[model samples]
Structure formats: C-alpha cells, structure tokens
Target: MNAGKLACSLLLSLLTAQLPACSFNMNVESMLSPPRLTAEQEQIYQKLQNSVGSQQVRLKY
Candidate 1:
C-alpha cells in the first residue's frame, strides 16, 4: 500500500513539472502593428479597392 501511494505521488509531481513546458508567455511589443505603406502603394491599393466596389455579384441558378 505504501509503495502504491509513493508511486502515485511521484507520478503527480512529474506531471506538474512537465506542465510549465506546455505553457507560453506572449510579449506585447513582439506583436506590434506592421509598418505603414508608402504613398505609391496606397494609390495602387485605392485603385484595386475601386475595381472591387461594394457589391457581391453571383452567377448561379
């Protein structure tokens, strides 16, 4: 009975020790926003947006 109890305690401690390895810590600054686009890129983006428009066209019966 004592051996069984010791084995259970050992297993529990090992499982707890391994828990931290599965956890993650996220740093806020590491996930900062992306840099802004240049003026020429912005113009191209606007043109693409205008071509797409605000409608969802469908072609099914």
Candidate 2:
C-alpha cells in the first residue's frame, strides 16, 4: 500500500479504537412503565420474588 493509504488506515483504526462503544441499558421509559399485571399475576410475582435473595447458587450445566 502507498504511504498515504497506510496513514489514512492507521488514523481510522486509531480513531475507531479511541471512540466509546455503545451499550444497551435500562432507561427511564423501561423503568417508569408498569407491566400492568393482573391481581393473580401480582400475587404470583410477589411469592416468587420473596423466595429469591441477593446470594444465589450457580448450578453446573
């Protein structure tokens, strides 16, 4: 490759490496919106939620 092409390619690679990568995250819209579950669903969710805690066991596949 020519010197100009090499320089351009290197500059492009450096610029791409320096740029921050985009990521998906839970935003306000998702956080604020309610799933609007029925009473029975809510009760089931509450029961299941109460059963779990911060500490969890990792089962081997």
TM-score of each: 0.38, 0.38
Worst 10 residues of 1 by lDDT: 52-61
Candidate 1 lDDT (Cα, 0 to 1): 0.77
Write down the worst ten-residue block by lDDT for model 2.
Answer: 52-61
Off by over 4 Å in 2: 21-38, 44-61
The C-alpha lDDT values of all candidates are 0.77, 0.72
Candidate number achieving the greatest lDDT relative to the actual structure: 1
Candidate whose TM-score is highest: 2
lDDT of 1 by residue, 1-61 (tens): 9999999999999999988886555888877766666899778767777788996433232
User: C-alpha displacement of 51 in model 2, angstroms?
Assistant: 14
So what's the TM-score on candidate 2? 0.38
